[model samples]
Target: MGLLPLNYRRPSYVAGSPRTMSDDQISVGSGGSGGSGSANGSNPPKPTKLATVVAGIPDALGFDRIIDGGTCPPCTTRDFMNYLIYVERSAENLQFFMWYRDYVKRFNEAKTSDIALAPEWTQAMEDDAVTRIQREQADKIRKETKTPAIAIFNGTDFEKRREVPKAPGSDTNPFSSPPQTPNDRDGSSDYVSTGEQSYRAQANEAFAAAGVKAPFTIQPFRKEMDRVIATYITDGAPRQLNLSDREQKVVLHALAYTTHPSALREVNKLAESTLRRQAHPNFIRWSICNGNTARVIFARVLGGSLIVVSTAIALALTLSSLGRGYRAVAAIGWVLGIATLIAAWKGMCVVLHGMHHHHVRPWELFVSEEDADDLGKRSFDSFGSANSYEEEPWVVRYHKRNLIRKIFDREVWIQEPALRQIQDTIFLQSMLCALLIAGLLTAIFVASPKGNFF
Candidate 1:
């Protein structure tokens, strides 16, 4: 969870360096500590430490390195995005950032092509276009029928029109003997029924059959851009982002002229800043709490209970006229209780420290199956199969365990050397504190004028 110092800087040839890519390409200078702009032929803006880390640049300290030593998965980034979506409920920023990355890649690939074109629209423009298209289609249908059309907008006709058409042979009389063809003889055919086609496939087939190509003005990826706007940029959207009015206006205005990635530059910068400054740090803190805080609380409660029981036993032993030596037996509980309490105060789980493993967090274990599947599908759709995110296998197994077994589970090893060192340091400190406390308490118990030596 440690962050880079304020003065930390990436090397000149690193991915986040000013010379590596444009400010917009890697989102350099888009964080809170980043410079204002990378314009006016001025020197390129220096990338902030957080920005560099996010851009996949390795820092001087390997804090961002993969914990298990292999680097393919980048678990920290995956966990950060998952936390934003599931815990913080601020997924739009990450979604927008990810979408922007893909957009940039596509834009670069097509930059030199003749088909590289941009769509332009405002809310009013889009609405008007849809209305015009509908009116034209209705006029064409009327002219073809040569009948006065009755306008019924109740959607009944629309639903009927959308129903899939039955196959030609399906409506034959059932009592008649069916004619055998090549397909029947083989029990298979190359032909696929329209009813079996997905809605998207059916729509594409309809358009192709009609020889109706949409106008080039519609632009490639126009539908995707509109979806992104509706889902993340527009007010009253399902996951509308927390953007400033000025920033929102800038984006909408830019879209009025072009759907190029440049149209989203300002909004992209703001989203990146929000993720780095707020969501990323908050995710780290939440991760720590989810991973260790519960264990600490359990330790504190058990430790306090032991301390109380130990004190009561020593008092009972004195009152019963038992020897002072017998009262010393309470020192065992005192030692363990104090050590556990000290460890808890340091946010260390004594059992996990000793075992060199951590428990699967409750949130991680209890994630709904639907959510996991949806996340996996979204990741695959957005980033492709190679980078698709999958829930850890241990998470599924953890969910199947009973309550008692779940509480005692320690399946995740502390793979990071730094984390192991930290745990060791905490354990050593707790033991020293326990010994000091036990010696003091034992001395008081043996010297008290409560019972004779046995």
Candidate 2:
């Protein structure tokens, strides 16, 4: 009987981006560059591009409009903050989405592979075959003693092989030399010391002594992040970036959700289109805008117009009041006018609500700065050395892990509440206008004497 089905078609995967099944672990390879081509037998793609990425997002929050090319709204500090968040979220979500889909695919392949060869071999086992499978290899040590006895290795010992020096080489000089200069072994307290030193520390120091960079201290390339974030503000709107599937969902949710609940949450791919159909909210305070910011904009515009009109009217009336007994009232009015003018000059601003806060530069998140100086010089094409960015680091995993740790533990600046309350004054103004209208209407005009000649 045939051991396994020959009709099995191994699933083809997107090149550069591979995923595992069962777990959401994803590993991006050289990229889907040729794989996308190969998958469709070298045919052209269905025209997916960055524009499609932007369009695919549901505009419930009107975030798409902000990113639209037009006269950008007046920029503010909050906009910068939101833009940074947007870029960060874009990178994060896109990466995860790539990871998740890739993982599921790999998982399917793995699951299929696990059963295919296992069942056939298990059922075909005879008593002798079973015994052979279970048997352990015997250690065959050929003890050849030379002038200085050194143990030699043959393949006889598969599990355990203890190598001993056969004899000192002719070139061996035991105490050759010591370094002329000794350097400080201690710096960068990466890990907390809690009494006894573990073997890990020795290993780390030994590794470092041999000129290896410290592992835990792998820090962030701040300049790259800043550059990437800055790009998102060009039109003062978030340009949708390339993100993985999981990342897309997370950011989409983050855009909608008020607070971060938890991370690494499972999201449904099937319902993604439906979920994204609603306009995604961009507001995370005053800076971020979503599709829903129309009301906010209109309100602000009307309020600003009102303030201008009010100032003009007060100025005109004050000129008249200067000629009469209303001079005391005019004095007070002038003081109020000056205060309002100063406030308008210094503190007044219209806050835009629906805005895209994410920015993504091609080389933004990929960089890991060894130092601040390295940030200004490195080529972002690939993960190159801080010293020379001519080529991507062969040690990608090691460098990347360090980069992630640095970013993960990074601190963020929390905005003061006072600034926020200042913006909220718009709401107060709206209420004041409503109350004034009501009070004036309520005061009964006893019928203007001259008008009602009753």
Candidate 3:
């Protein structure tokens, strides 16, 4: 109930729609903006914003017959341009949902150059080249550059002279524009993309020489991407990520030597090999939140609850269809609908998604053994635990650290601690709200309003 009002005044509502209002007390009209409990000018829904986001694409959300083949289909620059426009529009306009439906409709009907690559299969295709290059090009690079032999495998990240990044189709290799053969001339020492371990090590060395360690994620995300991509290709294909019977039977069902060694090492010590290898029951829809994969299971629970409540109200109205009060009952659905819409908008559904993935399920806290790739070594203890504050709270920790450091170093620091006080004020306001809601619900029956409109 408080969700609708609480999430109402948001500066930016990016995830979905806001929480719906109570069907019993509020009236959300048909006018645009869905009657968002706002008294200002009405604004329509922003569907395009929701659509552009790659997360939680509806199972029904896909092209009916997208082309796949020898020549890698180049995504239409125009369609991508439109998507960018929609993204920008959705970011600015409140009524962007009106435009969202049109964009999706355009996609299904129009030919888009932007091909949908299964996120899981990307690693395999990349590292295949890594291996290919290690065999064919590694020797050539060392002799030409006179530098240490730095092999660029079909690994995840590689520097491409091409403007658009991503693997070319098996037949349409993007490497052909100005083919990188073993015999190409020397003088180009910086051939590596920033994704490689050697590249980063070099970058870090340069930073150290300049007297600083750039605040960067020590995680070998590029290598991880490479490993995962390679596995997916071996497990299934570039077009679809559905693992084969063998892979599902073997890899998906059990734990093994994979991308995450440190985590596996710790978990293996705690659980038996059989249990450790058991498929993660809740891996169905987990995604990274600040580098930590947080499942949006809470939204599902809340969405389900709203649905049950709405169904009951709808049933009650049908039963009273012949009664004089039928009019009031008929409006009940609109009330419930608006309420659910509001809740969905407020990221309540996202919370439910989180809950579903974490509830009653034991999952691995380690990275998979995909580190078997030749390009690099996996960082130990990279994955953060489920309950660690090192996730989103890092921003706060940074502020706190800098604050204490200022006092310790005898430097004048006034910004962050003063900002912390403002945050505390907002926290107090939220506490007051919780109390107000409890008091209102408890006292509603005692203080009946004089017979008003009814």
Which structure among the candidates has the greatest TM-score?
1
TM-score of each: 0.53, 0.21, 0.18
- Stretches of candidate 3 exceeding 4 Å from the true structure: 1-321, 330-337, 350-454
The lDDT per prediction is: 0.51, 0.26, 0.25
So what's the TM-score on candidate 2?
0.21
For model 3, what is the C-alpha lDDT against the true structure? 0.25
lDDT (0-100) at residue 10 of candidate 1? 28
Q: Give the poorly placed runs of model 2, Cα more than 4 Å off.
A: 1-90, 109-111, 115-309, 315-454
lDDT (Cα) of model 2: 0.26
Name the 10 consecutive residues with the lowest summed lDDT in model 3: 275-284
lDDT (C-alpha) at residue 78 in model 2: 23
Query: Candidate 1: global Cα-lDDT?
Result: 0.51
Cα lDDT tens digits for candidate 1, 1-454: 4433333222222223222344455423322232343212212122222333332223211223322133322135555556665566666676667667666555444432322355323435435544554665577567646643433422366633543243223124242222332222333222222332232233223222222322222344433444555556654555576765445544554554455666666667667666654565444334322134456678898889889999898877876666778888998999889888877775666777777677765545555768655754464233222222236464456557665565465457655443454456556767777888888887887788865333
lDDT (Cα, tens digit) per residue for candidate 2, span 41-103:
211112111111122111221322332322133222223222333332322222223333332
TM-score of candidate 1 versus the correct structure, residues matched by position: 0.53
Across 202-314, the per-residue lDDT of candidate 3 in tens digits comes to 32332232222222222212233232223222222221223332222222211111222221121222121111111110011111110111122233344455545645554
Better of 1 and 2 by TM-score: 1
Candidate 1: misplaced stretches above 4 Å? 1-75, 113-223, 260-262, 289-297, 314-331, 342-348, 361-403, 426-429, 432-454
